[model samples]
Structures are given as C-alpha cells and as structure tokens.
Target: MFKKLLLVVFIAAISCTKNDGFQPNGDVLSIIPLEKCENGFAGEYPCNDYDLLDYISLEEIGGIGTKGNDCWGWTDPLDNKEYALMGTNKGITFIDITNPTEVVILGTLATRTVNSSWRDVKVHNTVAYVVSEAADHGMQIFNLEKLRNVTNPPVVFESDYDYTGFGSAHNIVINKTKDYVYPVGTTRSGTYKGGPLFINIEDPANPIDEGGFINYSHDAQVVTYNGPDTEHQGKEILIGSNEVEVVIVDITDKSNPIKLSAISYSNVEYTHQGWFTEDFKYFILGDELDELRKGLNTRTIVFDFTDLDNPVHHFDYSGSSAAVDHNGYVKGNTYYLANYTAGVRMLDISNIENKTITEVGYFDTYPDNDMAAFNGVWNVYPYFPSGNIIVSDINSGFFVIRKSGS
Candidate 1:
C-alpha cells in the first residue's frame, strides 16, 4: 500500500510540472509584464519565445574589428548580393553576408580621426558615406564595389574622399530619393551649430556641400513624402530629434531651408531619434532618457504626421524591458527596433491607427534585461533581401539572423 502511494505522488508531481510551463536551460518563454493599460491603449504582450542566435564571434572576424554602435546593409543592385556595413569606434567594417551561417569579413576602413565610440554609415549608389564622433573626424567615402573581388582576408583601405569642414557627426541619414545625405550633430566648435549638414551626393566620389538646417540636433530623417505638411508639396523635409523637442524643417532648398515647427509630447526627455512609416502617415519618436527620468520602461511615442505643422500625439507604447531605445526603422508595417539591452525587437504596427502595437517576434541577442543603458544592440538592419537581420552590439559585435522557420 505504501509503494502504491509513492507511485501516485510521483505521477502527480510530473503532471503538475508538465502543466506549469516549459523552461529550457533556465530561460522562460512567455510575454513580459506590461504597465496597466491607460488612455484606452491596450498594452503590448510579452514575447513568447525569442531565439537568441550567436552565430558570429568578433574573434573569428579577422580580430581587427570590434563590435560597433550602428550597422547598415547594402545590396549590390547589379548582382543582388548583400553586404553588411558595421560601424566601429576605430572604423567601418564591411562583410559579405550572403551566407549568414558563414559571414565573411571583407575589409575595414579605419577612422579618419582618433578612435571614438560612435560611428554611422549610409549608402548611396555604389559608395558608402561613414561618419564618426571622433575629434576632427569628417565623413569618409568608400567605394563598396571593392568588396566584389576581394581575394585576401580583411584589409584596411584608404577613403576615396574625406569631406572635411565639419568635424564630428553623431549620425548620418540618406534621402535616397533626393540624392541628398544629411549628417546631423556636426560641430567644429560653433560655426554650423550642430544641426543637420546637407550634402548633395549625386556624384559619390565628389560630394558637394549643399548647406544644412541648424538648430541643436542629435539625429534626423529626411523625406520627400506627402504627409502632414501639404503646403510644402513635393518638397524635401527634415524631421530632426533636437535635444528638447522634435523639429521639422523644409529643406527643399538646401541654401534657404526653413524651420517649419517643433513638437513635444508629455514626457519630454531627450528627443533622440525617429522614423516615419512607409506610407509617411505616422512618425515614431524615441526618447533616450524617458526610461531613466520617468521610470517608464521603453516608452515609444507616435505622432500623426498627417498635419505636418500640427503633429498630434497618436499613442505611446511601453515594453517589458527597461532598456532605452536608440534607433528604429519602419519597413512596411513592421517596426524593427534596437533596444539597447533587450536586443532587437520586431513589432507589428499595423494597428498603429488604433494606437496599438503587438510584439510579434523578437531575438534577444543581448540576453540581459532591457534597461535604459547603452550596453547591447545599438542598431539593426532588416533590409537584406534574404530577410536576414544584421545587428550591431556595443559589446558582442555583429550578428546576422533570419526567422527560425524561414
């Protein structure tokens, strides 16, 4: 009778454990906690199962390059091959990511100035424009085509053109449709006043300085879309993240640009960076210090850009992790975010009109809690043709991943 009782208890314990949940290697899979829903906004659900893939190691990639603060992927329009451009404190590293399983580091171009923690890259035509915050660092232009026939291992190459005048730049954005490259947060002491430096890169090798919109800017995005500011139809507009508020400028005429207006939401922390939807209907803004200042976890503000001059607060979404958002981009209806410590999260914003965002899928490359600190994923490039995502981690280096089922 005692033996029978022991068997029953053991069976019951196993059943209970099976019903509780599956914990693989001590990592739990479920939606993260969320703040109480407010203002009729349904909070985002925690990600179910996020696969953390650490495919490439920095030590394996020639050992000359370190993990960077930002990354951008460019596809060779001629051959449809994909190349990854990763920004490092020392320089920009290029990799051929055609086979994510075996990423190849083609080459690297060291910084023009002393090494610094920040670097940004943008591609136009067949050339890449790299900028960094190092002292006296100007934009370094490189012909990406050099990666086509690289037979040797990773080698450093001299820049094709060094546009020097403005020293350190915090970020670089390209208006591909207009053939203009906007370099924001530039300074040499106070001549340009660190706004957005506009350069006409119609000719990659020779970039002409086309003036800029000055104000104190940290990051910006230039677009020629028909949204909010209709009076400026078919005109180029610059949406900038100033230290205090988000600024909109009419940069159609680079020589005589006009500051249209500025917008600010409730929790006005540092207005860091933002992106517009593919349809150009809504503008998503990120506050760098909101998590620290207001104690709100991962707060992302959305603005209705239908009326450019008078932007309306659409809604706000908070995530489970405490990590602060650095840079984000909207491709189609999906928003790919670089949450510093939480890693790269992909959100489906199809319901942005209803002020709702659901965390469809995520890959936690950082494997740490998402706090408002600069320790993990800095930027992610999800534009690769194969749907492969390239992420740059401040500490872990570059990673190339695709959906597990895909």
Candidate 2:
C-alpha cells in the first residue's frame, strides 16, 4: 500500500526534476580497432567481447553541461555511408562514423526551445525526425542526405522543417512501411492526453498531423504486421509502453485506431520501453522503476505476442548487475540493452522459444558502481551494416564499439 501510494504521489514530483553535450576529436577519448577485451577490460572501460573503436566526450561536442539521451542510425542508400543520429539535453547531433578509426563530427542541431533532459530521434528513408521534452519543442525534420555536403568538421545545422502539432514529446516512432511518424508523450492536458500523434511523413519535410491515440504512451514501436496472427496480418500495429500496462492498438486506419488489448505483469513499477524480437514472436520489456523500488537487480520481462488480442507473459530474465535497465532493442538473435549503470548488455535470444536467454557479452561504461541511478549509458544502436555499434552515454557522450578482433 505504501509503495503504491508513494509512487502515485511522489513520482510526479520526482519525475519533473530534469538536469542536463557533445564532443568529437581524437583528443578526448579514442581507442582503435585493436583494444581487445582479452582480460575482460578494454582500455579503462570494462568489457567482455566488444572492443572500443572510438569515443567522443561531451566537451568535444559543445555539450559541457548537457547529457546524452537517445540515438538512431542512418545509412545513406546513395553511397552506403553510415552515420549516428544522437540526441542530447539541448539538441540533436549527427556524426559520420563510417570510418571508425577517424570518426568525424558532421554537425548538430540546436533544440527548438530550452534544454530538457529528454530528447529522442528517429529516421525513415533519408530524413531524421527529432522530438524532446522541452516546452514547445516541435518535431524537427532534417534531410540526412545533406551530410555528404558538409565539408567542414562540425558545424551548426538547422531544421529543414518543424511540425507544431504538439509540444514536449518524450519519444517518436516511425512505421516505415507506411511512412508515418507517431509522436507520443506530448502534453498531458492536450487533446489526446499524451498519446501518439499520428503524423504522415511521406514528404519528409512537410508533415501532416492527422490525429492521435486517446491514451498516454511513454514509448512505442509500430510495424507492418507479418506475425503469426492471421487475422491481423498485413495491418499496421502499435505496441505502446504505457506507464503501467502494455497496450496494443491497430493503427492501420489512422482516423479510427482500434485498441486490440492491454496487458500488465506481476510487479509493474513503470513500463519504460520494450522491443519486439526480430521474428516478431516475443516482446522484451524494461521497467525503469523496478530496480529502484523493488530493490532487485536488472529484471527484464518477456511476453509472447503470438495473438495480438491476447498476449501472455512468457518469462523473466535477471541480469548480472543491480543497475537499472532502460532502452533495449533486438537485432537478429541478439538483444542490445542500455543499462543505466551497467552499460550495454548483449543477450543471446536464439533459444527464446524454450524460455531460455543468456547474456553473451557486456561493456561497462560506468565502472564506479551498478546502482539503479541514472548516470550511465542512455541508448545503444546496433543496426549499422558494418557491425559497429553506437553507444550514447549520459555522462561519457558517444562511442563506437565493435566485436573484438572482428
């Protein structure tokens, strides 16, 4: 009773406290492709099988007091050049990381308003869409193809277009198959009450805000359904990470989105974010307050999403650290997790059907302690074609890592 009441009353006060950079240069922190993790330590950062390719500090990117938030990757189809699109407290930063040995800072775009601790970025086709918790900070769209035109090192870039459909969003998800961007966690007192604002981004620069879902969503993932569910196949589905429960909605029809189902677990602290397996059979979720409130190690929840109308809890996997688990993503048979203090953990989900999962490797960016505090890696991107992973730390800034001796 006390835990629930305290969470209801005290969480609102604590969640509003936001405090909040980028640096690029070989001078800050740089390790080449040879820092092997033989003795479980890559340079000074702890690791297992991943080596530190490059590191960019907050000071080098003009983010002295700001912290890193979220990140996404973009590969130029015209030339196959990979770039890292990262978010900070103040703005969004872009870096050309094709050459891991000599990572170049392409540029950065300032926030639409004041600096806020929460900022998120996503990409579709050739454009990047950015959103944040800053007041009146509308969505900032940038044409990513311009990166090839940047001859200088790191310059300040501006948004090609800004969509003012909503303000102060926490995150954004893109359904690439349909060219729609859903901006969620907007103002609580607004029309949709913090749900996802359905905006068509087919044109990239000019966005059309049609409508939104009628509930709150902290983060979400939308995809064209090709799962085992035959009835809902070929439709656009949205799995939302609500504060308490996971809500599945059929968003194929933008004007009339139908809620398929909602599910909650045994100990629901705060459903921060989750990701579907590559096969779209299971959903792995991370609750932000589970470690802090329950006094447990990193606990990851998995759910079988075979039937969209009735999802069931699969199993729970406990990590090897007391650090809090935040954002997580699955690529192929591996799960890339961003742990606040434990850094990024790589879990092998090849045998997920048997309810078995294992942590294959880990790279600890914060070696001090593995508490549930929020001072370590904020996000990780593993979709680069060259296998170079992007790690954005809240304190350490940006990093590019790859498999040792690969």
Candidate 3:
C-alpha cells in the first residue's frame, strides 16, 4: 500500500509540472511556423496584415499558472541575434527569437520578491534591468550577454546586481542615447513622489543613483532634445505621463530637474503611458481608464511639443475597438500600440500635422471581446531591427509577429 501511494505521488508530480507559480525553469515546446493572416484569422488568432510568426504560451514561457505582463527586446551586436525578454507574474523569461519560428527558451531570472502581476524590463548595453510591483522588489540587473554561452537549456539565472535605492517600480525606461536608466512609479512617498528615479547606468553593472523628479510621474520617455523647440535644444528632456497631467521636465541637471510644463486634458482618467515621434514634433498619449470611465473607444491623444513651455493638445485619434491602450512606442512613422483586448495595433502617424492617423495592421490576441477591460496584451516592443514585433499578452503569453511581407 505504501509503494502504490508513492507511485501515485510520482504521477501527480509529473501532471503538476505544467502548473503555474515558480517552476524553476520553463519547457521549450515545438516551434510554430509562420502563419499568414487569412480572412480574419492567422492560424487561430485574429489578425490583419500582420502575420503571426510564432507564439510561446505563458505555460511554455514560465508555467501554466503564470501570466505575462510587460515585454522588451535585446539585439546582440556581436552576432546580430534578437532576444525577447518577457515579464511573468513570477519573473522575466528570456527567449532567443532571432529565428522567430524556431525560438528557444534561453532562461529566466526570477523576481526578487513575491510574485506580482506587474513586472517590467528594459535593456541597455546588453544588460537587462528588470523591475516589479511586488513588495520590496527593487531592481534586478542581469547580464544579457550571459545568455550567449548557455550550455544547458532554460537555466535558472541570478541577478548580477540588485539595487535597493527604491523598491517596487512600475516601469524601467532606459535612454540608450543618454546612457541613463530611469525607474518610474517607485514608492509614492519617496523623495520624488513616485516620479522618475534617475540612475546613471553608464557602467551597466554598477549603477549610480543620480536623483529624481518630483512631479509623481507614472511613465515617461527621456530623450536628448533635438525637437522643434530651439529654446531647449540639446537638453535632456523627459516627457512624463503623470496621473492627472502630462508633465515635461528638463532632466539635464540631475540635482535640479526643471518642470518645463504640465498639461491636462478634458476627460482625464489615468495618464498611463506614451511615446514620442521620431521627429520629436508630436507626443502620443494613452489614458488607461478613459474607455471604461467615459464609455468611449480606444482614444489616443496627440500633443504638439513644438514649444517646450507650452504643449498644445493636437487632436484625438479614436480606434475602431474600445480596448484600453496600455503602452505604446513610436518607431519612425509607425506607432506600435498595445491595445489591451485589441492586441497589438499599428498606427501610421506619417501625417500628424494634418491630424490624420490610421490603423495599418493589428493582431487581436484576445478573441473573447474587444471590451474596455485589460485582458490582452500589456506591452509591445517593435523597435527590433529585424522588423520582428514582440507583444506580451496578459492571458496568452508572447507573440512574435511581423508585417505580411517583412
């Protein structure tokens, strides 16, 4: 009878291998081939011009129990290999997506603290800087180059450096151009009131805590000013998506960050995230709760940052679906938006001056419904040089998509 019970326990453990929660490592399933979008679907996923190259389910990325949050990409300059860094409820999973169809699960860096639904990652100088909303989870910095020489598969990795300067950050933004890492949404009562905590990551391993902004910024994009604003030319500017208002700061001087302007819209729900156009002439803003609160479609507001001191509201571009827009980034004229239920939608902003932006392509990961609820993609990284777009779905997992021909 004891031997039979032991046999049953062994079988149960095998069955539970796919279960969620910390699983130490992940399983690498068969690679999915490229499926072109036909009619209204790409394989089983609903898509348009965008074709699904491959998909790594949350279970395969981590475990069946874990859900994905944010995602970012890193391209190794040595071999020109692209990797997808996907955030899970527990930790961040790295995958070699150089060959999207036949990708491999490189490894995972478990969260510093307890698992939470919110985790973010950004890469700089081949090092991935991760953050999570989990309690006491400050920042986990892992050497991404270590991925190149992995002898065994799906190895459980450790952080090279852990900084406790501030705990629990919502997002980590790296201004590669300026070589500074900004951790936003920190402790609300901290020095900057949850704004941007500037940490100079010039030395990727050892980061220096410079200072922070005081406007309570939830999300921001910092860039070296080369916009139409001649007054602030060549300055390091930060466009922050503060809750109730959009605040622009001149972070050139770490000791004294200057607030250039703070602007607000009419139906402001929650200023979630946004990105600037390549020309720096316009800034696209996404209000997280505007859809549910105002009963509106996915509305993306555009701001004309021509003048640093006074950013004027350009116009609002309403998407066909009512899915809440979580995060978006502008790559040239294309705006890659992670519309919650609508999946990853690509908008063309080539004609922003005339206020004409159109949705070029989209892949709806959540086929249930395009409601205002947050159930689909949390973030998208479209800046990969290979033209491969990687999206992080809250329910599904990681999606590697690209233009039909590209």
Candidate 4:
C-alpha cells in the first residue's frame, strides 16, 4: 500500500511538470524565432523567429534611470534616415536605426526634472517632443536634424526647448496635421486622475500650451476620421483609454473639448490603451492587468466605432500565450501588438468587420512563456517601411528585426 501511494504521487508530479507553463530552459531575456504551429491558422508562411538582431545593453548606452517606458522612431525628411527616440527614467536616448544590424547610439538628453519611471516621445516634421511623469518634469523639445551632424558615436546634447506647465505626463502623442501635442496622465498621484494635457507644437522647438481636458485619460490616439458620424466629419477626435471605459472626445476645439461618449466591455480590467482601424470602423483596446487577474491570455477588446456616440463591442481576441498586452498599433489590415513576453504579434485583421483576426506571424523576443510582468517587450514600431520591426524590451533592451524572407 505504501509503494502504491508513492507511485501515484510520482505520477502526479510528472503530470504537473508536463503542464507547467514556465519555460525554465528558455531564454527569458533573449529573442528567438517563432515556430509555425497549426493550432488554428490554415496556411504556413515563413514566420521568422525572434532573432536577437542586436542588444543595446544599459552599460553600452547608459544605465537604466528612474524608468524607461516608451519609444518613438523619427525619420529625417531630407536624408530619409530613420532614428529611434527611446524614453527612459532619465530622459530620451536617440539612436540611428538606418542600419538594423548596427544600431548607433546617438546620445541621450537627461530629464528636465528628477527622473521617473515613465517617459514618452513623439516626432513631428524634424523635431522630437518628449514628456515624463517626474516632478517638475515638463515637456522637452529637441531638433532631430541636429543628430545628423553628430560625428562621434553617442553624442550627448541638451534639450533645446522646455515647455513648462504640466509637471509630469505619462504619454505624449503628436497631431501633425493640427500641430498639437496631447500629454496624457499628467499627475503622479494615482491612476484615472491625470487628465490629458494638450499643447501646440507648430513651432517644433517652441511649444505653446493650448489647453487640455480633465477626462482622466491614461493613454489616447487622436485622428481625423472620415467614417461614421457626418457631424464629426473632418474633425479631430481624441480616443482616450480611460481607466474604466474608452472615452471618445471631440478635441477639435482644444480650449473646450466635448465628451462624445464612453464605452466599456465585459472582463474589463483596466482600460489601458487602444488604436483605431485605418478605416475608422473598429477600435482595439488593451487591458493591462487582465492576464494576471483573469487567469487568461492578454485580452484585446475590439469595438465597432462606426457610431461615435454608440460604440459596440465587436469581438475579443486572446493570444495563446499568457503575456500581457501593452501598446498596439494598426496599419492597414495588420494589428502590431506588443505582447509583453510574447514579443510582437502581427495579426491579420483584413476581416475585422466580421470580427476575425488571424495570427499570421510573431517574433518572440522573450523566449520564456508569456507571464504577467513588465520584463519583456514594452512597445513595437512596425511602420518602418523597410519591414524592419523595432521592439523595446524592458529587461533585454532593444531589438531590430525584419520579416523572415525580407
């Protein structure tokens, strides 16, 4: 009887080991290629593995500051060279990514105030605009063209313009068409309290505070959509990822913005960030804490934004891995998702109207199974024309990748 009991316990232990989700031998901090699995997809394309193209070690660039959160890629209109502007606790690090194989570290501009964990960057014309949530850390402006003249590697420089008014900001987005900058999450007290701070950056180096709305916006994407509402035609609409709901606001008049409506869906656990479809019909939202709290993969809530006042939840697509969803962007029919440890996932949303998303390819930067943590890919930029995808990893650093065959 004792031998039988021991045998049963051993078998149970083996079963548990087989079902374990942790990848102990995996490269938790290294990029690896993704293998093709027919769990759902019909066709098998050449999906390249998440190869570690290059790792920008903190020692090589600069030690991590208070926080290194977001990044933006700037392209020189004259030379047509692409540069990466990374947001750190200290400030922003500019790198020339013209050569994916060899990422050149241009330099970094320290924070205007004390360093914080969160910082965001955006580019307009030829200038880069940065914002951080550090105390007294207002917005800083730098001319990106100056980077072209850097003869030595890692050339350090100071900010040319410091736009003061808001002390701290979580994220900043620029509206090139209107020359306006939207700074979301301004206060450091807590979530759902910081409103979006709007500033006009028509004069690259010099920014003017136009005004902002206190709608408690955490992150947002602004665009002038021609679909749906006729009354809002050609008007700039701000889609904010509020704490509990997606707030749609008409910010055409920055001084006095009107709240269009607020939309929410089931299993909503922190309405963090979202992006709109190219046709302005659907809005993809990312729940920051759903994976940890809900015991499921990161849930991406898709909503029909056809009616500005009445947004409907169309469908929810959850990845196979358990990685949490962070920031995502839509280009044409593809939804580029920064799936924490899962790396960057490219979803084919050609049939978004039917609420169908096919995972065509994925670059698993974090070899470990997706878990609820901020130690993996934080953000991805896939609009780099050259098919080279750039992922900013929290633990492993930055990676530059191209499509498999490309």
lDDT of 1 by residue, 76-175 (tens): 7666667888877878888887545446788889889788889999988888999898988989989888888899968777899998857889989888
Q: Please give, for residues 329-377, the per-residue lDDT of candidate 2 as tens digits.
A: 9999999999989999999999999999999999888878899899899
Alpha-carbon runs more than 4 Å astray in model 3: 1-33
**Could you tell me the lDDT of residue 405 within candidate 2?**
59
In order, how many clashes per candidate?
A: 10, 6, 1, 6
Question: lDDT tens digits, residues 23-79, model 3?
Answer: 113222222336778898987788889888778888887876899899999887776
Q: What is the lDDT of residue 101 in candidate 3?
A: 66
Pairs with steric clashes in candidate 3:
20-65
Native-structure RMSD, model 2: 11.6
CA lDDT, candidate 2, residue 338: 98
**Candidate 2 Cα outliers beyond 4 Å, as residue runs:** 1-34
lDDT of 4 by residue, 1-406 (tens): 0011111111123333321211122111111222222342212221233333444654455674333467778766665566887766667888887655556898889888887777788887888888877887878888888998999877678988888777788788766677888888887453325777777777766677777887787899988768777878899999999888999999888878999999888877889999988888899999998887888876789999889988889999978778889999998888999887777888889998887888887776667556777767788887764455677776566666655433
Residue 184's lDDT within candidate 3 is 93
Question: Candidate 3, 49: how far from true, in Å?
Answer: 0.5
Full-model lDDT for every candidate: 0.76, 0.86, 0.86, 0.74
| TM-scores for candidates 1 onward, in order | 0.85, 0.91, 0.91, 0.85
**Which residue pairs of candidate 2 clash?**
21-63, 21-66, 22-61, 22-63, 23-60, 23-61
Error of 1 at 19 (Å): 44
Instruction: Give the 10-residue window scoring lowest on summed lDDT in candidate 2.
Output: 1-10
